[model samples]
Target chain A: MGPITENHLPRGLKLLLILAACRGPEPQIPIDPTRSLTLQTDWKFTSPFSGLFYDYYRNENLIFSGDLRTNLILRVFNHAGDSQYDIPLKAVLDTLEDINSCALFAPDSLFVMEVHSPRYAIVDKQGRVCRVSSLAHALCPEPGNRYEVSGYSNGIASNGRSLFMSAAWWGDCDNTGWDPSISRFQYIQRYHLEGARKCRIAKIKLDPDGSKVHFGGCNILPHLTDVPRFSYSGMERVLLNGKLFLFSPVAPYILQLDTGTLNVVHRIPIDFLNGPAAFFPPPITEENLQNGGDLVSKPSIAGLAYDTSSGYYVVAVLHEVPIDTPEGENHLDRPWSLIVLDQTFTKVAEHIIPGKLYRPNHLLSTTAGVYVHRNIPGRAGVVGPKTFHRIILP
Target chain B: MMRKVIIWSVFAVSCVPGSQDARLSRYLQEQIGLTERQFPKAIVVVSEDGCPHCDRAFADLVRPRTSLRDCLFLIRIDGTTVDLHGFMVETQNVRFDDDRSFKKLAS
Candidate 1:
């Protein structure tokens, strides 16, 4: 065989090298020790659990909260943050079938959230799947989980024109031989949504300097540092002013990334809360795991949104009762707590909500208030079917 | 030459997703039907094992929630090339051309 030369290089291989070089370096978001962005919200919810999925419509003209079931409800909220029935989702998702996953909706989106064979679809106002195009994936390795870590799209959000997606990563290092102390990760590929801005996928490094953070299982690493993930919440992108901000569903900090470059420009760590796993919560039982591998439980900021009307950052905190639960059982079904932070990301108010969050973006912060989904446990009578709770914080 | 073919056949026939977490395989098999019987888009998400964020994300994806099966997203977390591609019997021969975007699942 003739000696291989530059001319013999496959065209695609050459293009790949060019893309890799231009892909740039992995993101390095500095941990600002000076930012004490934590707060103490003594406020507590007094209402019964009512609804879960919350999304604001038309600049807070309408607020909708539903059980994410057959009932897509719209509620009207007064300036006092109280709510009553307004209408239902413009697109009926409850009666809709064929479309899997949550009904991804945003005011600025061109197509309602739909995934199909080629893997892109759009739903109409009538809750019908349209323009179902199954584009073939190039079989590229998912950017975030390089070592074959299992994960999923966390939630869906849009920036007026383009859609932004965030995913969760979980796997074990027991036999992988990777460091069990400090976390190693594959660089997330930045994606360009057909209509959205250039999205640079950054690597997630959650070495939180001895703070207690939760992974899937009870097996806690003594320490973890550098926590940054760029997945946006489904209800609303972690958008403030004009920038795309992101938070690890299980981490204690928020990241602000450059819109064009998708690089971390600034990071505000939620230092007030304890992190790096003050202690590991027990692993989910095989029964509770259902099918996923066992997971460690710990404190986390599941969802965050900047409420325009109230001018507060509504954060959903999922953890075992910070204080002792009345039953004293370390139930994995920790009620999602709602924390309100100011422009500077300081905790201003907090309330213990009554619901179990199944997804990181299950907690939706709207202009009126926040909505959270409560997953039903095995004991139907105890937790009941999944529902959303509309909270009015004082 | 015939021996090589025989060995390859055995390998192909035995190429089951036995290496995958039985729980995850079942969960994906259950949830992934986006259209009339069409499977949702399957993507490989990469993260180091034993990380907290990755752990939480992995659990959230695998856990079955609503009876209302919406858009089923297919996620293959980690495993050997065989484990990643070896889903159904027909997929035993499904090979990704390379690590490039929009890889057509050549069945």
Candidate 2:
């Protein structure tokens, strides 16, 4: 063939090459919630930063993540997902109390919501514990537990000034808490921080009556002593427009309740909310669920989160995929898939995490990409090292 | 009881297909880079020169099968070493202490 040159190339080929250059940096891949993310472990920190949803971003798309108690350190990341700096907390907050769960209150500080008590602490960037005060009795009131069983408040998220916490595992009528065989009702409480001085707890009546509708707490039964077909069940959430939307790493669904009315406004069913399906008692209520109805075939929803830039929800589902073997037959398989959906709860895109690459806890979408961190907890206040995977999506 | 359990395990292993779907076998072959046609008898964690925990995990999941040289998965326990072979569990009557890994019946 004569010398192969650009001039000899077809008009379409020339145009394609020109357009590719105009597109900077290989047209950044839109994060495929279904695909495995790139694992970045360069940020060096000793303590376990257990806080989920590292979504608070400042200038240069720099996102902030830290815990007033967990790791007692702050980490900043550039839009490129590179760690900028580590801010130590021992210098900031003087209250020796370890935080139960915490979050990035703003660009300048760490918001520590007390683990068992009613105090809220704010540790600023300059290593200063700015505010420490008791929440109104209404917000911090003793949870009667109904069954008077153990009380645990988790899934903490904030909209700058206010804080939201949902009850993770509630006991059944007899206190057989978190038993997969039996279902239990659930609720989340909201508190307006003293930052504005209201510091009062907003009493959410929880639909007040038991008969009409009560959100069910997901399951995590450990006594089975055997492998559970599906063990994806936990409540974690985000607040939008004063409403509390709780999701699970277990259940394949998102629940929206009116904080004002405490009425379950919507139970969005993620039909493809991949997870192990069998052996779970219909979730206290069988209103809306995308479970496959059995254990033989199911999807694994490892984590869920909301992306501000896209106004869409990113759900990490470890789906049981079927692959043909050398025997010429297909067997069901489980792998990670990061799914993105619009605010309207419509499926937007599906990205495969490619093989059993990640075990997701919280999925955070950002200018840099997405962060999947599993809360690998160690014994009493000690947590495992920072093991998180970050990947750019397309 | 032990004899019955072992006998039942052998029969079950021979009779029933593994508990996992084929996608898992593909993951072992593709993601973790395992070889095809290799009958995985046990999963061994090839420790990185001197990683103790990796050694333990390898030992923990290493339930000797009838045929040792037939196949073995050397996973790295120091990092995110997914026991893809762990998912290739057999539906045999053998009690799966944790359902993490199971031995293949002599074929």
Task: For candidate 2, write residues A1-394 as lDDT tens digits.
Answer: 7899999989999999999888865323233444433223322222123333333443334444454423456676554446666667775346735445555546666655554555656667676777666442333233432211101223355555444554322223244334454333222111101011111122222111211112223222322213322232234556543456665443446667666554557776665543331234232223323342343333545556655555667766656543322111111124456677788877777776543233454455554445665333212111233444554432
lDDT of 1 by residue, A83-165 (tens): 53333433533323222233233421112222222133454434454444432221123342212111133333334333344
RMSD of 1: 25.2
Q: Please tell me how candidate 1 rates in CAPRI terms.
A: incorrect
- Please give the interface root mean square deviation for model 1, in Å: 19.1
Docking quality level of the chain pair in candidate 2? incorrect
**CA lDDT scores, all candidates in order:** 0.36, 0.43
> Which candidate number has the best TM-score?
2
Among all candidates shown, the one with the greatest DockQ = 2
Candidate 1 matches the true fold with a TM-score of 0.40
